[model samples]
Target chain A: MSLAKRIIPCLDCDNGRVVKGVKFVDIRDAGDPVEISKRYCEQGADEITFLDITASTEDRGTTIHTVEAIASEVFIPLTVGGGIRTLQDIRDMLNAGADKVGINTSAVLNPEFVREAAERFGAQCIVVAIDAKCVSGPGEPKRWEIFTHGGRKPTGLDAIAWAQKMTAYGAGEILLTSMDRDGTKNGFDLDLTRAISDAVAVPVIASGGVGNLQHLVDGIKIGKADAVLAASIFHFGEYTIPQAKAFMREQGIEVR
Target chain B: MTHLAVIDYGMGNLHSVAKALEHVARRADLTFKISVSADPKVLQAADRLVFPGVGAMRDCMGEIRRLGIDEILREQIQHKPVLAICVGMQALMERSEENGGVECIGLFRGEVRRFAAGQHDAKGELLKVPHMGWSEVKQRAHPLWRGIPEGSRFYFVHSYYVQPHDSAEVVGVTDYPAPFCAALARDNIFAVQFHPEKSQDSGLQLLQNFLTWSGHA
Candidate 1:
């Protein structure tokens, strides 16, 4: 069977509000995360990911409620992340109708947490989110370093090496985000994405710096990512998921 | 009332499948009760059953054996409609090569084998393991495909695929690098390697079809 590269719409929910997300939609009231998600599913998004920037207890409840509401209507898979520290958090998200849960800082803190959760919940649902930025000297070789605490804390771990380790630890997928390209609207860091994808046997999702439809295609074409995750591009009605899929199909890339 | 019980051995996306069935119940205008249950009595009482599984086949079978899901499956398969997915489908085979050849429920006459690592497609591009993402499934005269179109994309994430001893039991085949069983059906049992719950509209349709189907095909 011809497996089409996936297109995922990421929702960045900050304190129950859509802050710095979706350039075209009004951020007030978080624009109803449930409603926004349903529209994307109708437009043929393969999956939806929700990131709670603050990840407070109150926001966690809100995220769970939002996931329930969206899960009731949306037929596709849903992934939720941000401040998911323990196994209980993953269980709560999955119980709240999330198909997958993304983990970042917690995994960096306790690398074994990846193996623990994957073993308990199955690696199929454990997504290790890597937020990375290129670090290099003028004459030295360049490499992407893993950043945690929402890209604030530099862990000094090589992104590519960490990806390989996470895979060995039983991570089903890697959500790799480029801190340098995020919100820049330039394009994805194809080199970084390709490196991690090449290093791991599991699927890698390319995030950050998606300006147009072509960037999405390039993620799969040049970066060799299994999926492309975007926020404002689809949030503000910049481009519907169907339009993006059509463009990718036109480029001889399979999209569903 | 139609009740669809999703067998829970503590793995896979049971809620997603339940939610999709709930949506299909409303959309199809059919009254239904969907439940995710580990209790044998609750599962045995349902009008239909959905066996959803994920993770490594070894652990999946471990929980299945621990919870006596195999016994329940055998008893229920004779009387009610049962739908299996992913590792749930894999576990129906006689054995699996994953985790050094784990024996399964022997419900279907087949063996599950791992896809060759470092395999490449016709284009010479490297084919990754786990086969994650959406793939088009070619239908083959199955009642579970009643309202769905042929060649519809279904989400797949697995390292091993089933190689049934009897090829006639295969209903849907998808070509990742080579043709393999994507779905199979016999008697009242219907199983698929793809995740219909995550496959969007077409997937919902498949669930709806399962909800309404009797144990005929």
Candidate 2:
């Protein structure tokens, strides 16, 4: 059999609790990060991602404890992103049992950080998280730009070129999130996903908009993503990971 | 109590590996005194050994040499049930083409090679390096494969793979466009290119099998 396309359920953690918000607004508590992660593992999630959205510096420590708790019980790959600005942050997350650490704003702010982190920690554990927003509109030449600060600030870097540069800088994987389609319950930006997936030699994980199981399938079959990461569909009890996997398998996609 | 020592050389995280073994041990109602350390005395006194590593080959080899784990591994593999995972498996090979080529432990007469650039799968799609994700493992007859189904999916995250001099030493094979040795078994030593701790059910089953495996083929 061939390599299975991974289905990852992302948990947005705030002050150690799992929370969900539409377009990063009107956020509501879901449950405990550890308990939610264990449930996802039981439901056959290939991996679990925890993005720390805590605003206060003191609350950041809570995310580490949360990760540690889930890592002790959940025997699957766990990735921690958001606020991963320093090597100490990366080490703390890995020490807390995270398999990989995703860097977003830091990589754009200092491209050399990706290289240094990769050399020190190994490329296998360093994932570059890119929040991309399409800048070109209607029938024009399609283009996307990298955005930081939860898609609020624009970096003006071409998404495709940045992805290539990151991989060149030794990023093992690319976590691409489409800011335009995120939280819209629409689907992934197939064009954006395919572009980055084909641009880099490292595995690309398609994140952001995944409204249904069909979206997940398209992320692989059409988007060419090696893994699909979604929050709302699997987080809000709208669908379970097993249902998603079963649907994907029915569509002739290999899944674990 | 059976002492299970996980050799840690400051290479990668060993928390998950130790936790998984403890998880399986509790489930199977088996008592195992699991220790994650680099101490020679602790390793020598252990009944079983697990060598788990991640990162560049040169760094791993450097630490192994600094900690004198190379000598300990050489001695332990003679009789104890030893399990090497991921880069730990690659380290057992004679040399690797990573970090401008690094010499390995040479426990097995083989070389570790990187997945060449511009490789394609059957569908003509370009394959990625670091070959990260879950892939089916074609199993051969081995005690470590016990309880785990043949052709089961195991989690893999590596760019380089092992090539043994003797094909008969291979216990499991997987394809990332091309078939490579996924698991190698010889005498009491069993090495794998995937992470059994993060592999969910099939992986847990493999770890469970490893816990109960006798020092024999």
Candidate 3:
């Protein structure tokens, strides 16, 4: 049998509670991160990702406690992203039972931090998160630039080139998020996903703009992403993970 | 109570492994006391052992040697049951190509090899290295495979795979463009490249079987 395409449910967490932001605005509370994660695990989610959106230092402590509580009970791969700036931050999350940590702003700021984190903690646990926004117009040559501060600022770095560089610097996986489509639910940026997926040798997880199970399939079939990450589709109980997997399986995409 | 020690060399997280064992042990018929330790005394006193690891081969071997777990593993494997996971399975080999070729504990006659770049599957699709995902594991006859079906999927995350010199030692295999040893077994030792702790239900079943295993084929 071949390796199954992964279905990961993204939980945007704030101070131990799950939240969702539409296009990085209009935040809404969901539930406890730990409780929601357990439900996702039970629903046959291949992995669970917690994006800690809490900006305050005091509230960050709650994220770790939330991770610890989930790790103690949930028997699945857990990835924590957002505000992972240092090796100590990565260590604290891992020690709190996170299987992987996503490095976005830190990697773009220093670039060397990716190499250092990989050297210290192995490439398997280091995931480079790239937030890309389409800079070129529809008729133009389809160019995308890396963005920081939750897709608010542009770094002028090419998304394809940055992905290749991160993998070369020892990133085991790439979390590709389409800033333009993030909460739009129009489906993933297929062209952008395919570009980054083909550019890097490591696995690429396609994030943003997933409204239905078909979007998940398109991410793997058309975008060629090794995995698909979604927030609202699963969070709002619009569809269960099993249903998504079944639909993907019917579409002939192997899923566990 | 049966004492189980999960050997920790500070290579990777042992929290999931310990927690998984505790979860399975709760409903088990036998009482279990699970501990995560690097101390020789604690390892030597355990009735069963779990060797879990992640990271570079050189660093893993370095910590294994520095902490004297190599000797403890060699001693404990003689009689008690032992289960190795991920890089821990790789460490049982004679050597590895990782970190520019490093020597391992030599419990099994094998060598670790990296997944060659530009490898393709049957569909002509380029297979990614590190093989990070859930893949179906084809099992052979073994106690740890009791509740797990013949081709159940398990979670795996690694760049290199073990190649035991003797085919008789391989208890499970998975295809990542090609068939590779996913699980190894002998009289008192059972090792796997996949993480049973993070593999959900099927993985939990394997660990539950491991807890009740008698160290026999």
Candidate 4:
């Protein structure tokens, strides 16, 4: 049987350490990635996702060293993203003890890269990430488009359509994030989530805009996402995974 | 003499559970020497045991036997109080689906099965499986519920449930699929589906009660 809905704690790895911020701005030193990951694992996080935001641009290796150190101690699935362009990048990530590899820009630029990665490392090992932002202004409010290079540039590619294509190309899962809601603490964009979830067969992890217990519950129950991803709410001790799952259970969502 | 041994069965969040218990002990104004060990000598010297586990029931039981501490654990449980959380509580059952159809610790006379939507619990569409979160525990005078408020919420995360052979052993119950048992006590064996160490102040009180309990059964 498939796992129950999971509450995942996401760690943003800058250089070699874990960092946090509001709206991904004013970065503050959170702690070592390994230490933070261990804490989350102990607190009962179903899984951990580490996003190396600077790796792709810096031409540095995937934070496999960080993954190895953390995975050696933590006995849970570790999903890694950032700077994952080629099949070699995916191999390095998985070899470093990462259970899955997330690709964003390269997958968008070369759609075939997604297919190739899936061929090399089983579709289940490949996760296509879509960082989308709502663009409304010209004629009928343009659909949410994809962003790359750490949410800095807009690709003008429709997110929903691209998600279907990515899954078609061989991604096992889609880590869809709403840039507009990335650090807002408001809640998730249900419309975008539903659209993509409906378009793809793979599990959709609804990321961004988790402010409180209700937000987590609403994201899963209302948004119909397979899992909910959050950071500040967990890292700051605002709520623990068990607490969040309890609230979700109350709302009748099947969470682990 | 108050050394609390948290069993590292190789399939659980042992360190975090130890830290939480340590915090609860500090809060209770009791000094509890907590450590994670698989040594039988360490298990024997402990005043109490907290059997904490995560993942599948079969894998957990395999770890217990793999570490060669299953017999020692059964022997120790007869003399001292042992608290099992989440999957650790599930391991006390007779069998589980996750174990590739293998038997569990058989500590309790029941099988651990998934929380099927309509079959297990009474409610048609009320409780969901993998019951996660902080929920209220309704108790009727169990030692494990000592000092814990009525309807006080505790943390829980698991899909399988322990159906005790004797109904009286279920001291606390929660409304998930029509009021299932949340806490069980039989002789010196005490197990809860919820994580008391992570349940904040109210949960810490429950841990304190376990520490001081005389294991009178």
**Runs in model 3 lying further than 4 Å from the true structure:** A55-62
DockQ of each: 0.64, 0.75, 0.76, 0.03
Per-residue lDDT of model 3, residues A1-256, tens digit only: 7999999999988766888888987888888888889999999999998887654222343367778899988999999888888888888888788888998888998999999988778789899999999999878999999998778878999999999999999999999999999989899999999999999999999999999989999999999999999999988999999999999999999898
lDDT of 4 by residue, B51-160 (tens): 97655555567777888666877899878888888777877877776635767787888766656643333323223334545567888786767777788766665556
Clashing pairs in 2: none
- Model 2 whole-model lDDT (C-alpha atoms): 0.89
lDDT of each: 0.85, 0.89, 0.90, 0.75
Better of 1 and 4 by TM-score: 1
Report how large a share of the reference interface contacts model 3 reproduces.
0.65
**Worst ten-residue run, lDDT, model 3 chain B?**
B27-36
Q: Candidate 4 local accuracy as lDDT?
A: 0.75
Write model 2 residue lDDT over B124-164, tens digit each, in one string. 77788989989999999998888888898888999899999
Give fnat for candidate 1.
Answer: 0.66
Find the 10 residues in a row with the least total lDDT in model 2 chain A: A53-62
Q: Which candidate leads the pack in lDDT?
A: 3
| Stretches of model 1 off by over 4 angstroms after superposition | A21-30, A56-62
Regions more than 4 Å wrong, model 4: A1-176, A184-187, A194-206, A209-256, B117-129
Q: Which pairs clash inside model 1?
A: A1-B174, A1-B175, A1-B176
Give the clashing residue pairs of candidate 3, or none.
Answer: none
Model 3, B1-217: lDDT tens digits are 8899999898777888888899999967669899899998899899899999877788899999999999989988988999999999999999999878999999999899999989988877889987999999999898899978789999998899999999999999999988999999999999999999999999889999888888967
